[model samples]
Target: MQPGIIRLSGLFFLLIGSALVLSSFGRVDNAEKDFSPEQPCEWVFKISDKSLALFQDKLLDLAFETASSIPMNPHIKDRSRAQETVVLACLHLDCPKRALRYMDQIVDWRRGSCYADLAFYFARRDCIDDARRCIQIASQISESAEDWRRDRIRVKIAQTYVWLGQNQQVDEFEAGVVDSELGKVARVKAMRSDADAFHEQMQVLETRMESGNFDIMNNTLQAYTELFHRFYSDVQKRSLVEEKIKTAWNGMPISTRIERLTDLAEFALEHSDSDKALALVNDAQSLIDGRQWPLEHFIPMMGKLAALRFRTGDRQKARSEADAARVLFHAQKDTIVNIWKAGTLRPLAQAYQTMEDPDAALSLYKQALAAGIENPNSRPRAEDLTATCLSMALYAVEPDDDLWGQAHRIYQGLDHPW
Candidate 1:
């Protein structure tokens, strides 16, 4: 791994960084938003990075016991885990729609982790109402809105610049192409060599960010985020990004390292350097874990890991990572600031399709599509995703199921969904 590898979130719900959650953000339900758990909640990653996997695994085991109505073995821990066992048991026993009822079991829903987990569960199923409720409950326990807004604005802007650099649009240098189309091809190379030529303009706009031209800042940010992601993922094909450009990137404030490290991670993958991808991802997770950022921030990274694991033939690990990606994508279903590249979901979706879970693959494809729409500059990309998803649906879905009709509808109704 290179210097300044990003540290990802320790929690694996899973994509916070790069399945950069294939992310969705929406309001939580209010009716069942408040509840009290047997004890105050604690984040699982804070306890063990493996805790989430264990929770799900143990839940399945506990389900068998619950089905037979057997007592769970005694194990010392927090009441939250036991409560989660029961709640998941409830959902397992045909009460998926009654997720809210289980929410009532938690004491002070905002102060506990169960509500959040449940919210994530509902989100995976696109149970927006229940997910929203869980989100509301979790929000109640977080930093005050004023403080969060302030920090988010600061973080969002840094993220914007980092993304711009990664998505820089420039063709690779080719002497022959330049000779053939002097002005056009050579100009493209010039742009690549002077990638930061926009720095002066960016500085001007960045200044206005504090002055409250948020729309301009956000719109500009969206445009640049897409560009930077593109540039970083494809950079390995070239010899060097300008040295000054590299210096500025490496010299960026630590606060902005999340996006930079993430792009580098993708860049590593694009170069077929799985070892580097793994190293960079682990480093980024360390950073993410240290920051205690929201779970959404972890998604893309986990998704990246999922892709890596799948490539390395660790099917179980890949499945676990992909599952985490799916959960986070649904749970953190809001937030326009994505640190991961677009198309990050394709591999995971393809993995699922390979595993014969067309439904899961289709969902991920749609999630990626939704994420792609956040940037107006990535419309072509959005179309790429659409085309990919449509093709997947057409080929992967079994004709016997009603999925073909649904796929046909999607192909007709939507612009693009990969």
Candidate 2:
């Protein structure tokens, strides 16, 4: 061979060797062993360092081993895909440093895939700065991405903002996507409604403060009470809302005590904090028992006591309390109280079932179903209880019966599958 050609061949071999070495290092650092019979050489990657840590703490090695069963293309030319895979592997290893390094590589790609994945990764890490950067890049990429991808990116961005305590930003982001290319009509509508209601309530409270209209203050408090009830499942957000309500309530006259207790009990119930609900109910009961309050106060306290008893697995006591509450509600002609009273019967039936009294359970279940049918909207939860009771009754009679089949059929008959 000519001298120049020989030199060129040597240079080419050197370059190829360097590339091969780099690629191999990348693979070894991210490589996961797969012992599954079905998918050898495949790597399963996680994307959250905290989640990986949790899995490790739980000693869920089997899950990690199973995830490693997926295969990768050893010679794939896409460096971005390789980086993504590495990021996932590092996450699975609970190595945030390595995961962030690969995430940077993907961010350099500046594509929709990179933006979406990196946004979620940063959000999971609670790195708000990186998450915001990812959101910006994602927004730019979203202009050219598919509609579904854009919608997903928008929701992720909103969620990230929510995590960062930028709730107003979440509102703005959701509003922009409401009727836009994103197809999240229902979520957008609900969020917008909540934001609007919260704002309106704030305004009403401000106005009442200026005008000294205590009657209007009642309306403002009620609005917030309802709003908190509607969104109480979210602990952090509910805490913030409750703080605001308490601050406002404390500034008002002592005459608002009963209403405040009522609202707090309702909030506790909505959040599934049965202990808190019971405590608030007891506070109300003290006023009634001391003759400082009326029979109406005792009514709500009795209902809450029944609910607390049922939650604590004391169904017999719960049933007695609920029966008394039912009579009081009927005498007062309070539909809301009646609804709560009817709610107790279903759980009472479950208590009977637990006590091995199927006959009593069946009778209570039938009564609950009849009450529910008469006031469908008021007892919206009764259908599920009815189905449960029917299924349990069938099982107690004959363990081999097709109770599940019947239950499935009943679920299908319902307009909404709740």
Candidate 3:
């Protein structure tokens, strides 16, 4: 761990300095538009939503209990996967002890990766001792991993060190990736390094994206996001990057296009660029409106669109969209599998919550939990139950005792949650 590791939110400010602080004008969400010196991290980390904090302690308790209740799968691979899922959920809930507990059960190289993530999470929270312990464990595990896996784990560790602002340790960890082009690009972003060098990296990434490789496509989008944030004030550069992103997205499937555009739209919202966010949202909306996708795909996407719409100050359209989605959901509910039903319901509930309709939100959340009960398959049921629990924990709505009890029984009942 770094000797002078500061808080994550403070480090973010230091990274950008005063010159990059965004104006709060045209903010659309319910959060106070102006950035406070006390909460600078909120602007960059969506998980820092105040609503989540309100329920954080309860969420962590439920998360730990739920994780403990899940039965271990007989197969090592399956067991590791299940543990990884719970570890990730625990991390998201800011329950590092529980995360580490589950992560220790993981039996694959991924356990090393998870440790790196835990280290990053700890670093963000300024938990230096815990972060150092996880980093040591991760390094030890990486030493015995296959060459390729070791390299990947090294990159993850390097990234964590970068987050801790430990330049010396970052250089040491990143040394293993000196020959890797992708690693180079990743390091640049992790270190908040030279902007001009990223231009060449962006070109390489864009060219790879043209090949339509899914991983490269995602990397390209992430690169665009990094560049967009880095050069947000440079209108000409931002426009050029946006144009390239749009061009790249043109060849993707309609669903993929909608998802990617909305992700960019959400990023725009984070930066208080409501106009850009709306434009991107509109682009996604047009695609959703014009396309004829399967109802299963359509409903969930619609739910997401409704939430984004509400966030962008189009509450009326958002409500209309949610209503339309609910009707479609009912029309096809019988045919939809329990997994998809839960998926669809959760987002719809989120939309309603954002719109300040607590009753509607609570009802939808209950429905989401019930949908998992309808599943005959044990694994999907367990997955759905855990996810619903996590969602309920994060949302403003408090689940009734009955709902939590039902989820607890389902988690305990599963013999193979993998």
Best by lDDT: 3
lDDT of 1 by residue, 1-418 (tens): 1111011111111221132222222333332233454553333221111122332333333322221221111111222223334444334332433333444544322223445445544543445565555555554543232333222222222222232232332122111221112222211122233345545433443443343333333333322332343344445412233222233333343434444445455555556777756665566556656554444335544555565556544568678867977766566555435424334555556557655577887676565555645554322232333333322432243222343343334323333231
TM-scores of all models? 0.31, 0.31, 0.75
Error of 2 at 228 (Å): 12
Q: How accurate locally, in lDDT, is each candidate?
A: 0.39, 0.44, 0.61
Give model 2's TM-score versus the native structure.
0.31
Q: List runs of model 3 lying over 4 Å from the truth.
A: 1-59, 64-71, 75-79, 93-98, 105-107, 122-133, 144-152, 161-195, 210-212, 415-418
**Alpha carbon lDDT at 346, candidate 1:** 52
Better of 1 and 2 by lDDT: 2
- What would the per-residue lDDT of candidate 3 be over residues 1-418, giving only the tens digit for each residue? 1221212212221111111111222322222111112321111222231234545456545544554443332333333444455566555545556556556655567688778877777776677776777788788777766666677667778777777778788778877452332333352352353567657756765776776566557555656655665666678877877787778866667766676677667667777888888888889888878666766677767777787788888889889989888888888899875556776677677778777887888788778778766757565565565556555654546766776676667766766423
Which runs of model 2 end up more than 4 angstroms from their true locations?
Answer: 1-160, 166-168, 174-279, 283-304, 309-319, 326-366, 369-418
lDDT of 2 by residue, 1-418 (tens): 1111111122222221111112212241222221112321112333334443332322222212211222233322223333344344343344544444444433222234345545555665566666666677667655554444455556556655655667787776556542232322222222234653655544644454354456445545554555555566756655665666666665575436554565567557546787776676566455445554333335434544455556545567666766665565456544443333334444444445545556765565555544433333311332233323322332232212243344333333333211
